[model samples]
Target: MQKMAVLLSGSGRTLDNFHSRIQEGSLAGEIQVVISNVKDVLGLQKAVNYGYPAFHAADNDEINRILADYEIDIICLAGYLKLYSPPEKLKRAVINIHPSLIPSFCGDGYYGNIVHRAVKARGCTVSGCTVHFADENYDEGPIILQKTVEVGYNDDIDTIATTVFAAECEAFPEAINRVNEMGIDFFWDRVAK
Candidate 1:
């Protein structure tokens, strides 16, 4: 089974979801460590509660060291707020789940409720989530999987967020499974020159 590491900066909803999947044998992996960028976040508490090695690290070098020490096979950014430019050696192992479809309501300053608000304000009829390879830029990398969710005409940001998050709960694990099946070589070949 692939050993995984999760990075988060908010509520541990996504992390919890992953843990549930892992425990249920739906996901072919184990979460070896959880890292948060800030202190007192629920994500950290969730990690601790689950008996996972959890820490708060603002430095990329320290984060990289942790990943190496754990021999993590894949790095999942659940709700990590900071931009992490993975070193070349680790690039193929890093992935992130974005709230909105890439190249849409994504990029810097687009996260959490902010992304949902943008989608609702645009009067969009469709919105969804994307899981993709993590690179130096925000939400710019090879797309692995995307799942769309319909936006009801009267749906407010909160409603839309709830709907999309549900989709995310499904999509993220599916994407991770696909990535695992693809193997690390698939990502290595697609890495930018």
Candidate 2:
């Protein structure tokens, strides 16, 4: 199984869900490292409980050290809110999950519940989640997978969040599977890997 390091700056529900999949044999991989930029993140404890190495990376040097120590194949971001500048050697190896479609409901202050609120305010008929490669920019990368959720007339911020969250719980694993299974492919008129 391939190893992946998850980086999240918030509650860490994504990591917890992945752990469950690992136990059930739905997802296969070792969580070599769990790096949270925030010290007080509750998800850190979840990693510790599962006996995965967890740490707080305060700066670029620290980030490089952690990534090196783990020999991680991919750095996955799940609700991590910090600006992460991967070492030049590892930039191509990181990815992230954003709760909205790219170049759409994504930008500054457009994360967490803020995303749901904006979707409702805009009266969107549909909203969902996106898993994309991570780059220096915010939520702007080549899209890997997306799951759309219907937005009904009665939808509120909480309801929208719930709808997207469910998709996330599944989409994360699916996207990872796609990357590890098929890899990304492109061609002049066709693509494969």
Candidate 3:
């Protein structure tokens, strides 16, 4: 199993899903550490409750130190809002799950409910989650996978968010498993392009 470090800025819904999948032997990853930019968010609390090494780190240098200390194999950004600059050696090891189809509603200032609201405002017929390598920019990395969810004209932001999150729960683990099976070398080539 690959060792993972999870970073989040909101509720622990994605972290919770990872825990559930790991417990059920579905995901081929072990969460080594959990870090949150916000000190008191549900994600940090859930990490502590799960008995994983958890911390509050708002500085990118501190985050990099923790990742190095833990010897993390994969870094997963569950709902992290901050931009994390991974160390040179770990550039290809970071992954993130964006709540919308990338290139649509992703970048600085676009996340969570904001993304959902944008989709609604645009009258998008479909919304989904994108699991991709985390580059220096926000949501601008090589996509590993994307799962689409049909959106009705009347679907509210909350409804759209819920639908996309369900797809996210499946997509994140699938991406992690794919990385585990295919190896980072495969992604290294893709990300280099």
Candidate 4:
């Protein structure tokens, strides 16, 4: 199994969902580590409760230290808000799950419930998640995968995020599966480049 590390900046509902999937034997691996931007985010506690090593790191230097110390192979940003300057070890292996379809309403000010709110306000007929490489640009990366959700006439922000969250759970594991097939180190160099 490939070692996985997750980064989160908020409540980490996605992380919880991933952990649950692992426990249920659907995800098929270890979380290894969880890094949070804010020390007191509720997700830090969730990681602790789940017995994963969770800590605070504000920038790339700290992240480099953390990943090196843990010998992490893959880094998935699950609601993590910080912009990371990748060290060579993490460069190719880092990925992020953006809440929107990206190049559309995802980036900078768009995150969490706000992205959904923007989509609903714009009257988008569809919106979904994009799992991609982490780049200097927000939500802009070579796309790994995406799963779109149809937006109904009456869909509210909450409804949209809920639907997108479902897609996130599925996309994350699928990405992980593809990662496993790629064999961690091999793909990291290519993707990172």
Candidate 5:
């Protein structure tokens, strides 16, 4: 099984989803470690409860050390808010699932309910999720896969968020599985200079 490291900054709903998928034998990866930028969040607690090695680290050096120590094969960014600059070999190994489609309500300062609110304010009839490789920038990496959800006019932020999250529940895992199957060399070769 491929080894994975999950990094998060919020509720860790994605973390929980991955755990469920793994337990159900849908995802073919092992979560070697969990890192949360925020210390007292529910996601961190959930990791501990699930018996995964979890830690809190905001410093880039600390994060890199943890990743290196675990010998991670893939790094999944679950609602992580920081700009992660992984070393060249691991650059293509990092993945992020965004709440909104890339080139849409994504990039810095757009996350969680904030993205939903922007979608609502913009009156977009469609909103979805994007799973992509994490590069030096935010939401600017090569696209991996996307799943769309309808956005109704009457839908509130919570409702829209819930809908998109449902799509994410499916899309994120599928993306992770796809990446795992392709292996890290697939990514490295494509991005090789």
Candidate 6:
């Protein structure tokens, strides 16, 4: 089974989703650790509540050391706001879930509710989520999976956000499952072109 270490900076909704999927036998992996950049965050509390090894660290070196110690196979950024410079060996193993279709309402300053608001401001007819490889840049990695949701004419930011989040809950785990099943080589090969 793949051992996952999640990095988060806000509520643990994504982590909670993963746990539920794992418990239901849909995800073939276990959360080995949860590292939060900020203390007193809901995500950290959830990790502790779940009995998972949880740590709060703002230093990259310390975070890297903790990741190495856990022998993690996958690193997931679930609402993690800080920029992460993962060790070279972990480059291909890290993935993040973005709230937009990517290359759209994504990049620096385009996280959380901001993305939804952007979509609304642009009057987009469709909006969704993307799960992709995590690179040094924000949401600029090769897309692994995208789940689109229609944006109704009257949809407000809250409605759009709710819709996109629902898609994320499904797409993120499916992307992880795909990576686990096909291996990283397949992912790289498919995106190489």
Can you give the TM-score per candidate against the true fold?
0.94, 0.92, 0.96, 0.89, 0.93, 0.96
Clashes of each: 0, 1, 0, 1, 0, 0
Encode model 2's per-residue lDDT on 8-62: one tens digit a residue. Answer: 8878899998899888888756689898888878989889999998898877688
Model 3: worst 10 consecutive residues (lDDT sum): 184-193
74-191, model 5: which lDDT tens digit per residue?
8899988899877566877888999998889988888889999999999999999999888877888877789999999899999999999999999988988888777655654675
In model 4, the runs with Cα more than 4 Å from the true position are 183-193
Name the top TM-score candidate.
6
Winner on TM-score (1 vs 3): 3
Better of 1 and 4 by TM-score: 1
lDDT of 1 by residue, 24-78 (tens): 9998789999998888899999899999999988878888877777877889999
Clashing pairs for model 5 are none
Best candidate, lDDT: 3
Ordered list by TM-score, greatest first: 6, 3, 1, 5, 2, 4
lDDT-better candidate, 1 vs 4: 1
Candidate 1, residue 140: Cα displacement in angstroms equals: 0.7
lDDT of each: 0.88, 0.81, 0.91, 0.83, 0.88, 0.89
Query: Candidate 1 — what's its lDDT?
Result: 0.88
Residue 164 CA displacement from its true place in model 2, Å = 0.4
Q: What clash count does candidate 2 reach?
A: 1
